[model samples]
Target: MMRREATGEAAPRTPQAGAGPVPAPLVASAVLGGAALLVWPAVFNGYPLVFSDTGGFLHQTLGPLMLWDKPWIYGPLLHAFHWRVTLWAPLAAQALLVSHLLWLAQRALRGTAAPAAHLGLCAALAAASTAPFTVALLMPDLFAPAILLALFLLGPAREAMTGPEAWYLGTVATLGIAAHLAHLPLALALACMAFLLGLPRGRALRDGARTAAPLLAAIVLLLATNWAGHGRPALSPHGATFMLARLQADGPAAAVIRARCPEAGWYLCAFADRLPMDANDFLWASDSPVNRDAEGRARFLGGALIAPEAQAIVAATIAEHPLAVATAVLRNALRQLVTAGIGDTLGDDHLRTALRPRIAEGFPARERAAYDAARQPRGVLREAMMPLAPLHGAALLLSLPLLAAGGLRAWRAGDAVALTFLAMVLAGALANAVATGGLSGVFPRYQARIAWLLPAAAILLLMPRRRS
Candidate 1:
């Protein structure tokens, strides 16, 4: 009574006549049900899918370091999440993050949703699509779309968010963008595109800064991490080298090399006489001059002399063959969107031969047994999902128009939340496609990482708003 009098506050009221609090058993059931839904893929497959690149990631932290051609944060994050070789912890953490992002997205456009609704939609998504597969896999692909999703929340739907919610969204968005080097540029591109489209006219810029700040922090974190781990002062030095590969496949870079090789004492000049015909051949074949097994690759990556030369060659070739280069980039982007296959590179012999021993040194025996018994020894992605590929392709093709229609409807009605989400997702998909397909070359996994959004946008577009 004295405490109540001091604060002038009333005692809490009980839930009314017959209604008590929610049952603990029901809450537990809901949680368990949600987990089962999200990780059902892992259960269906008996274990998480391990891609060919999984070993490269595992090796970075569990074994000897490898000079992976991509970003390095993914490996250390795995080690941190591995929880002393429990093995399943990382994927569990990924699932949690994915679920959280889905929750945020459910509310992205001032769209109100109960916790049950968010869980149910995620459950539906996990069962119907490849989205959950990424969460359970060891690859960085999931983070790509996750980044875009977070950016959509932070950039456009920020007005609908609380102060703490903004901070959470910003942190997750940064981590997601920094998960892959490709994502780094993709985030900036999306932001720039949004600005250009005049979507961020008012408080959009101020709130969008919330998105930008985290990406900036992530870049700094990357440069510092690379410095500590790989002695590099910048993001991956493989960009020019990768562009060289693309140009080599385009035919003009090789032609230019042949013309310049006679007097150039470059190692590539020596191989001009026996040049490989395509990007994969030039970059990965045992006979390629730039194969990691070959001296050319080491020399090129070793900060010696080849990278700058490759950059020069790429620029010169582009100057000479702009049309061909542009054509290749366009073709690759188009092909990426339609590419339906997923997880084709689920295993590699190199991981077993060179990486597994190191894992054994630190990997717990129990988890090792579990891994081998389930995900290991190689298996193909089921052909059943193959039919769903066309649907994925068609949804992506339709995302933009859905966003435009929704945005227009919201604009006429003055719903900032709907307008923001529509514009942001539309911008994000286009940017993601350009960064992955345009830079990394056409790969199904790259495009599929964000294709779920096409359907998601379509769903959001059709959602009826609350009456004012």
Candidate 2:
């Protein structure tokens, strides 16, 4: 039996090293990938097939195809094929993207066999663990990991790039923009990293421009496509209006307060008992009488407050209640790391029950009543699982310490790759916490995206260094 080499340690070079048998890391990654593909579907069989807001994404993409002849819906190229083939499109895209990301990781870890192994293991675990939440979702969260992984791979390449690499980076940045606007931050972070890493001033500027240009172009393409297809851009008015309204409400102080208070519901304050509220909530409630009337509705929209008014509120809060705001932000960041009791599993159950009586009085009366009665028992399952939810929560809680240790070890070792990995993870978590205003009704599934970073970083730090 062949012994597997320990991670990050270099394998001995052979006379036929360039043409030797396939690397061990690649083989392990393949096995891990295969296992993920096999087991994920079964584990999450009863989970909802439709993700929250998947309908919105489908509407954005497919709605255009139904209405006009535009080349794309939101990006430079329309995922027209993807729109038509709904059932398999999202899954297929995820698989291909993940495979590409893993290959890129392999390339990034070329010299350090140990780091490569660690990254491979991280990829495998991420694939398996996150699949239940990410795999079948129609939203952009699934695509975020692939973009982040690509950024991780490209971090080291910044130092050694020629013209072609710049173009490649530009293309990736374009894709990142098209995939999700949230990912634009990662692209910006990379450009900042290029400058900080001491690439020649001229080359750094050139490379940065090259990478950013495509993203800009993609944005333009997105706008133009929307303008040509729909009378106006599909995203502009709605997104802008929602953001503006959020800003006008409680401001950033409200956002800060929301972040600190983890008990606030996702879109309402009713689901979780421990949710927090402050002056911001008062201000928000005051401004949006409609939201106040609806009660639980506005809480979900809290994420939109990241714009100007919210920023001003946050700034003022920092100035006035600096200590309090800082404490809240930190606390929220911590809460975001754990798989706490967030989301509307119970709320969903109650809503389902209430709707049953209404369905009995409405049309399609027999079928609707039967469906409701059948699902009532599943609500019992949902309740039963409520007690066991803490077990999953504990697992997430345990991983954080290990991740912190890994992060510290990586930082102390002066490993740029490790540092970048940690930075990306922290940035993502911070962004989510600050932007979303705490974890309140956040679903456990969302944590799947960045959860593997801690273990991956730890593995890299623990892997033995190869002889130079």
Q: lDDT for each of the candidates?
A: 0.64, 0.43
User: Among all windows of ten consecutive residues in candidate 1, which has the lowest summed lDDT?
Assistant: 11-20
For candidate 2, the 10 contiguous residues with the lowest summed lDDT are 11-20
Residue 23's lDDT in candidate 1: 52
What lDDT score is found at residue 26 in candidate 1? 49
TM-score of 2: 0.57
lDDT of 2 by residue, 71-190 (tens): 233321224434342234445455545544443343333333433453455454444344333443435655455555555444443432334544554565566555554445545555
In model 1, pairs of residues that clash are none
lDDT of 1 by residue, 1-468 (tens): 111343222222211211123254543454445555677657765666666577677777765474546567787788888856665788887777776666556544424434465566666566555576666677888788788777766665654456676677777777777678778877887666445443334454665575677789888877876677667767765568777887777677888889888686666787786653767566655556774434534434432235677888888888988888788777777776666345453444455654456456768787666666664344333543355555545555665576677767766655555555666666666777777677667776776677776666655655664221
Q: Which candidate is the best by lDDT?
A: 1
lDDT of 1 at 115: 47
